[model samples]
Target: MKNYHTHTKRCYHAIDNEEEYVKAAIQSGYTELGFSDHTPWHYDSSFHSTMRMEEDKLDGYVNTLLKLREKYKNQISIKIGLECEYFPKYMDWLKQMLHDYPIDYIILGNHYDDTDETGIYFGRPLTKQQLTKYVDNCIKAIETGLYSYVAHPDLAYYDTDDEFYLQQMRRLCETAKKHHMPLEFNLLGYKTHRQYPNETFFRLAKTVGNKIIIGTDAHESDALLDMKTYHLAKQYIERLGLELTEEIHFLR
Candidate 1:
């Protein structure tokens, strides 16, 4: 199996060293493993958080992963990437980082909207305007053709109005279908019992024919290929009759 959304301790919220994750992937029978730790942003200092690694640590992150890739080349295919929230202001920076680093891909994880001026985390309650803006940003990010897939597309997690949720979600799925961008059915959501893998979102995606990929979104070593989580995702796919893709293709 292949998983492209693993994380590293560099992202403070996660635990364990990078190598531990690699070993876990091997033990879990993953043929292809990707390290897509939460991306470090070049945002203004005032907007910084402990959510990601520091900008200076990017080189080390890449170098360490490259070394592991070579070391484990005979055992598994290793890819290096970053999971990032799309902020238009940092698009240029992202482009340059991709060019400068040996990164293979980026997954758009729209966990936050608004801006340094007034941003709101997705985990908290959102205003109607914020929800609309979240969907708009997701669309704009996909249009950039820079991300491999939109990770946790159901992360908007709105339960206010069924009609509004369906409308916005359908729009996102339709856009992804048009661009041939796959949407990730995140396993972390199932493991954490978070709002994602929302039945309504995937049901609509199935109707719209949006491609799907299962992401472990592994924040800790043990989460790399948790069979229980994998089974849960598999059941969801089977139940929804969703089309699942094994790999991601970068637009660039």
Candidate 2:
């Protein structure tokens, strides 16, 4: 119930404000809420490839959240976090950023597997070979001892069949299990795609028996505190007999 990957408008695609998100969390009866905006990757001035809080606004963003945390002390607990996109080259800098800043936690969001030849993404697809490499990089990122959780391990499943994608997801599950890292069952994709976990990915995740954590991945005030898709997905997970770990606690 601790929504760990909520976003704000500075990310360019979100539609919520910090105060609105906090109020929504309280209204939904959550005790804790963490705002994790997408961290900026080093890209050569390309809007499509890189989405983040501009360097100039970074201080304001962090300070505003810090102030909100104090303001909402009695109402709820707020944590400042980052849903970092994976880029191995920036690992050191990312580490310093988190250490130097007042960040509470970090989560992995493997939006891009690698930097393209152009030093920026340009509609490249994930190959089986590339998927394996990318996942390994993500695991290494986890080994860096920075991330608290990982979001959407099956993100590159658009091109493959169930069996093929399941194999990919299993690698992530195995890695997470080995590292004791938690996997987030994101709900935003369900709202847009109209199928939770994209079918192949969810079925495979359930079969593999990885420790699961529900994440709404909300970018709006309403969804920041929502449990609709999460509840629906949990129902399906129950029907499938996937084991929910004893630590599956809801914030709301």
lDDT of each: 0.86, 0.70
lDDT of 2 by residue, 1-252 (tens): 567778898888888789999999999887888888887654544544336776566688899999999999999988888888667777777777877788888788876655431332212466667666666767777677677777766565445474665666678777777777777767787667733355566666667666767677878888955577667877866676665542322212
TM-score of each: 0.95, 0.85
lDDT, candidate 1, 51-118, per-residue tens: 88989899999999999999999999999999988878878888899999988999999988844335
Positional deviation of residue 10's Cα in model 2 after best superposition, in angstroms: 1.0
lDDT of 1: 0.86
Error of 2 at 153 (Å): 1.3
Candidate 2 wrong stretches, greater than 4 Å = 42-50, 116-125, 158-162, 194-196, 243-252
| Alpha-carbon RMSD to native, per candidate | 1.5, 3.7
